[model samples]
Target chain A: MNEHVKPVELRKAFRLVNHGPTVLLSARNGSVDNVMAVAWCCGLDIDPPKLTVVVDTIAHTRSLIESSGVFVVQVPTVAQLELTREVGSRTLYKEPDKLRNSGVSICEMAGHDLPFVEGCSAWLACRLISEPHIQDAYDLFIAEVIAAWADDRVFRDGHWHFETAGPEWRSLHHVAGGHFYAIGEAFPADSNGG
Target chain B: MNEHVKPVELRKAFRLVNHGPTVLLSARNGSVDNVMAVAWCCGLDIDPPKLTVVVDTIAHTRSLIESSGVFVVQVPTVAQLELTREVGSRTLYKEPDKLRNSGVSICEMAGHDLPFVEGCSAWLACRLISEPHIQDAYDLFIAEVIAAWADDRVFRDGHWHFETAGPEWRSLHHVAGGHFYAIGEAFPADSNGG
Candidate 1:
């Protein structure tokens, strides 16, 4: 485990993706591991930490997730733009393998072969919650976040400190055609008419 | 109508929220009108423009949506930070009306009185799709975007030209408390390596 990867409380797990950064989805089936970038996902709950991510039926990673019944969602920082876009646009269904040169690495947890992307700020190891109807109909997968981890440098005390993490470490949002916007400066406001 | 607001092609409506900006939700039933902010939402489909936004059972907006069977999701610009936070934190369940003093305004469409945040960049007028189970269990509201609109200055030609929209016009991501990250910059990359 990387020294910066620390366990996050499930109650606070929602914060990892709550700000809506495009994420890299990873899954392993047998000896095969794959990764892809996705922007259509968000935290659905806090207690058990349920997350909803859309996975098209034709996607290879979707097959891997279905067969393995497990997957990981990693929040990549701006520094990983090329790798994120590469993996998202490329497919391994017809190719030999994606892990060999996908510019991402595998992070083993206990005995699990979890796929991870370098320069990412957070990770969510999830299990399928089994809502087959919606999964097939809407390409929407609801999963339970079994374990959560975050880079201590960018995330501490259950909140993101992107303002202090600098631009390279800040999460980025995908805006079509390979373009992205780095999550920018933070400011405070009070909604009490103050 | 604001000159900046114009109809967005229905098939391209997903692009408005595809980058994952926190949105201000507004609805009306009878003489009551309300507005609130939510971060857990995204486009669910493209063709018919389906969107999913989590509406907590306790939120006053949820009742209005249930009763009226319609609502609008407005993408607030960074400039509306204070008003966005105010509407999200305050409750209109007991208050007389938020439209009068919420610092936001009403943007009526044809015969509808949909509350909208001034200076918001995009709007999605929606009708509930009606999923009782998910509504009660997850507070999730899946709706079909019946009409879509965007600030032509920021979004045009089926794409979000946030690059030239400036800071205040760019969308934002909500990060707990009153802090937020205004969407910043745009750079292109290759989608190859397939």
Candidate 2:
């Protein structure tokens, strides 16, 4: 594990995805591992942290998640724009070298057998909750976050330091085909309000 | 109706919220109307657009949505940060004057009776797709967009022009407590990859 990768409290895990950045979902089935980008990931619950993600039926990574019953949701950075687009566009079923072609390297954390992308700002190890109906009808999957991690330089003390961190470390919010806006300008709301 | 609020094509409605900005959800039941800010609203599908939102059991807005089976999801801007915090923090059940105290003014469209929050960048009128199981167990609601609109200044021609619009028009992404990061720095990914 990278030295800057630190554990995030499960209660505070919702904050990792609360802002709605596009995320990388990676899973392994037997000796094969696959990765894909998802823009529909959302925070579902706070305690016993849960999140919702929409994985299309055609996505190869979706099958890996189903077979393993586990997957990793990692927050990719602005620096990974090209990588994000590639993973989202290509499929592992046709091209077995999709990961290598997309310039993706897999890393691992102790005690967790899932594959974690090498250069993301945060990681959430999730166990699928298995809502078969929604999964069949809408391609929507729900999962409970068993553990979480983040790069301390960008996120620490249970909060994101985007205002202070380098712009390259910012999260990517996808708009349309190949277009994205990096997160910017952090400020506290007026004290008189919430 | 505001002159700038033009109807958005149903196929393109998902783009209005694909970036994951914190949104204002409004609904009316009988003579009662209520609004709340949600960070969990996410795009669920493309054609005949659909969305999912996690509305807690205690929310006054949730009850209104359940009774009416309709609601409006509007993308609040950086300029509405204070209003967003106030509405999310105050409750319509306990304080009858929540809307007025929170500085929320209700506006309307030609055919829809729902309360639309003024000064928002985009709006999507939705009819609830009630999934009782998820609502009871997860506080989650799914809906199909019935109609959509956006301020031409910020969103038009089937795309979001945040890069050219004034900073105030940028969407707000909530982090925690009163903290938020405004959408920023629009750029295109390398075309060769995707």
Candidate 3:
């Protein structure tokens, strides 16, 4: 693990994804590790932070999550645009070398035995909270973020410093197809308003 | 309705929120109308487009959604930062004049009876898909977008033109508190890679 990869306080874990960036979902069932890009992830709660991510039935990563009951949601950066597109478009089901073909390098955290992508700005180690109804009906999976980490270079003090970070460090938000927009300028509202 | 407000095809309605921008959710029950800011809305399914939003139990708008069973999810622009913060932080339960105090102007679509917020870039009139389990446990509400519209100036032909649109027209992605990031530069992935 990189020195900058530090554990994010579980309470502030929602901040990792509060901005709504396209995330790379990675999981390991046993010997198999798979990763895929997901744009439907959203923050669900604050304390003991929880989130929801939609995984299609076709995604190989979803099966790993179903079996292992754990997964990692990591935010990819603008520098990984091609990598994000590659992993998102190719399925491990058909392509045996999906991870290698997508140019993804699997890394590990200190305590969790989940697959975390190498260069993402932030990661949330999530334990699947099974809700079969929505999972079967909507393909939406809800999970509690048991542990979280972020590259302190971009996120620290419970906030994202995208304004000061280099352009490549900015998070990617997918619009459609291969089209995406990097998170933009900080616009802070008047403190008195809120 | 502004002449620029045009209908979005149901299949492409997910595009309105695909990039995960903070949205203003409005609901109407009889003569009562309420609008609240939501940072948790996300695209769920494409065909007969569905979405999920987390409205805390304390929100006065949640009751309106419960009674009406329909609400509007509209994308807030960088221009509405203060308005978003106001509605998001203040509740109608305490401040009966929440909408007016937040500087929110309620508008309506031609066919739908739901309340819509003005000066937003896109709007999706949604019919709540009753899911009592998640709603009570997670404060998550699932809805099917029945009617959708976008300001053609910023969104047209099923894509966002944030790179070309004015800075104020860009979608707002909330970080925490009143802090936000407007959608930024277009980062299209290589077609060959995907």
**Per-model fnat list:** 0.64, 0.68, 0.75
DockQ of every candidate: 0.53, 0.59, 0.61
Instruction: State each candidate's clash count.
Output: 1, 0, 0
TM-score of each: 0.94, 0.97, 0.97
The lowest-lDDT stretch of 10 consecutive residues in candidate 2 chain A is A185-194
Error of 3 at A151 (Å): 0.5
What is the per-residue lDDT of model 2 for residues A64-136, given as tens digits with 9 covering 90 to 100? 9999999999999988888999899999999999999999999989999999999899999999998999999
The order of the candidates by TM-score, greatest first, is 2, 3, 1
Candidate 3: where is the Cα deviation over 4 Å?
A189-194, B189-194
Which pairs clash in the backbone of model 2?
none
TM-score (chain B only), all candidates: 0.92, 0.96, 0.96
| Deviating ranges (above 4 Å) for candidate 1 | A111-113, A189-194, B111-113, B190-194
In candidate 2 chain B, where is summed lDDT lowest over 10 consecutive residues? B185-194
Error of 2 at B91 (Å): 0.4
- Residue B118 miss distance in model 1 (angstroms): 2.9
Off by over 4 Å in 2: A190-194, B189-194
The TM-score between candidate 1 and the true structure equals: 0.94
On DockQ, the candidate that comes out on top is: 3
